[model samples]
Target: MKLQQLLSHTRKAVDEYQMIQEGDHIAVGISGGKDSLTLLYALHGLKRFYPNHFELSAITVDLGYEQCDFTPIKELCREMEIPYHIVKTDIAQILFEERKEKNPCSLCAKMRKGALNQAVKEIGCNKIAYAHHKDDIIETMILSLFFEGRFYSFSPKTYLDRMDLTVIRPIMFVDEADVIGFKNKYNLPVVKSACPVDGYTKRQYAKDLLADLNRQYPGIKQRMFTAILNGNIPGWPERIPYIR
Candidate 1:
């Protein structure tokens, strides 16, 4: 049932966002997490029958975060024969040791994303796919409201002006637990992380917020996920401002 749900969600996400196109050179951004690992596997499953003539090559960026491990990822990619590129940057040290950013995850994410964009472009790929799922979107929405004081969240599709790359979240319709289930069933090797020493990242807080909401309303997660994809919420903004 979980696998079926994952398949259905991926189908919806692809159709809704028009993420993958024929002749597209897609670069999957994998972090060795259940989300990304599941995404890679899902895409692989689709590759056998997808009508579109797109090519997939993954790029995993090593942020040099503590407890970071890429060995499992490399082995899995090898077994799957998915062309994978590993990019390394001392993002964790730069954010933690140098800037000492209050929220290292955000800073590290920004830096790693920039590096991913640059690398994908250098590889001559037009499309970059991320593993962000429904939960991440809801979390971002709540975070924006509570901290940034705005109605905001990552979009299903975004074309980066500076990077000249089309970014797509193919797992936008997938839930975190669904991804986990798929990962566990497939026995995907997930990279272990000890997290930042500073701790209490915005994502964690947002997750807590989501947990409470889930407790209050049993189906809140599914409803929120549907709302994001449908844009059914009243007065929801379409265009998100980009500083670039």
Candidate 2:
């Protein structure tokens, strides 16, 4: 598929969600993965002709792992002509040595996302976007269903009450394999997780389990993706009552 075509489809998503608007400044959470790079390039391509005016800034949170440097991503941002920021924290040690439970994906993601939110506010952004694609939506929805017995999925667009900023996922309609294809086509420089236990968490198990299910039932992934989009996704959680 043409990159321009892919970008056009993604732009429609950005428009529908009002992810960006006139004079909006957006901070993109980057992890040096294919999905994030795909988001950066899509915005880079769309910002020129998008009806609403907006800006893109790429931000990466470093877990302060040993010898982990993001200079390559910085340079790629330079070449793409987008401003980049790196927030370094001790996520590696925190995940590995301290508070390292058998199932730590939830906690690690929460802490990292909180830091990213704070950094975006500090940079004066009105909105922030993550690169979670359709597969992520499917996986997360399944995880919530199987483990928590809840039907919950992250919204494509969300508003934080306290900070009063919008959070969005522009790639929510795009698939993960498509993102990988785009990354390879662009020859993007990707950084791999250097952690000892990378991709070994409970979330990985969910991804693997989903893959197995798909093998057993072809086209199962599409059904899950549609379910997340069409079925009950528990947004507006702030309206719910607290129970003992």
Candidate 3:
């Protein structure tokens, strides 16, 4: 997607949900992946002209992978002039080597989020931005339906009362295809994930299933997204008048 289109979608979500407030300091969770890098770029651009005026800090939770190189990401953060932090941990060793979890994604995600939240708090950030896009939202809903027997997806804005952090998804309206296009067009410092089960996960299964469903039924994804927005799911912020 073009930069303008990205900004439009991001601003729409941010405005509709009031994700950013005056004097807000947001810590973006960067996983050294395409989605997160695209988010960083979008948020950086939004920060420039956004009327509310907020600050940004790019953060990454290192999963203790020796091969995971973050040099390019660091350089990109430098160019963007956003403070970057990487919380190094033995999460990989704990999940894969020590525990040998059959489903490492769940535990790994919990630990990673815990570490990321702590880091964000230490840096005095009240909000944390996740890189979940439209596809992720739908896929997560499907995953919950198939596995947990619930029809639910994440909200655009959520309050983590326990941690005193607000989570926002500014790019929730952007499609995965658009994210890929933006990443390639801008030559985002895309780094390969060194995790052992990068592509082999239940979420991947849901993604592939969604692709197949979209292929079989055209415009199905768009309909699903619209349903998500208007379905009145709990925790979804009602759209409010946006004031500059």
Candidate 4:
């Protein structure tokens, strides 16, 4: 997808969820992946004429992976004139070597979020923008249902009362396929994940299952997304009428 198209989807989600406020400063969480990079571009483009007048910054929690390089992402942020910060931590070591946990994703994510939240707070940001998209939303619902026996997914906007921070998913309306297209078209410098279990997680299983289900029953993804929007799930903001 082009920048304009990406911006449109992002703006739709932001406006629908009232994710941004006047004078709000949002820190985009950069994972050096296509989704996060596309989110960086989307919010940067939206900042151009968004009436609420919000500021943008970027943050990445470096998991201390030797193979992951962030120089290109830093340059991308510099080119966009957005302040970028990388929080270095030995999360990989703690999860894999020191802890030697069989299931490390949970702890790794917790540590990563802790690091990212601290960095965001130090930067004086009121909100954090995550790059979760439509496919993620659906896959999460599937995971919750199949694994946990619940029909639950993440909300587009969530307030972390304990941390005094609000997490917003601005690109929730954008599709993952579109994110890949945007990355390819824009030549986004995506740093491959060095984690050993990158693609061997339960989320990956849900993703593949959802793809298969969608192929068997066309438009199932859209229907499921609509259910999520209208499911009256706790924490989800009420849908605002589309203006255009």
Question: How many steric overlaps are in each model, in order?
Answer: 0, 0, 0, 0
Clashing pairs in 1: none
Query: Model 3, stretches more than 4 Å misplaced?
Result: 241-244
* RMSD, every candidate, angstroms: 5.1, 5.7, 1.4, 0.7
Cα distance off (Å), candidate 4, residue 20: 0.5
Q: Candidate 4: worst 10 consecutive residues by lDDT?
A: 235-244
TM-score of each: 0.88, 0.90, 0.97, 0.98
Give all candidates' CA lDDT scores.
0.78, 0.81, 0.93, 0.93
Candidate 4, residue 140: CA error in Å? Answer: 0.4
lDDT of candidate 2 over 158-239, digit per residue (tens): 9998888889888877877788788778787888877676788766888898889999999999998877666756562222
Q: In candidate 3, list every pair of residues with a backbone clash.
A: none
- Candidate 4's error at 108, in angstroms? 0.9
Against the true structure, whose TM-score is highest?
Answer: 4
Better of 1 and 2 by lDDT: 2
lDDT of 1: 0.78
- When 1 and 2 are scored with TM-score, the better candidate is 2
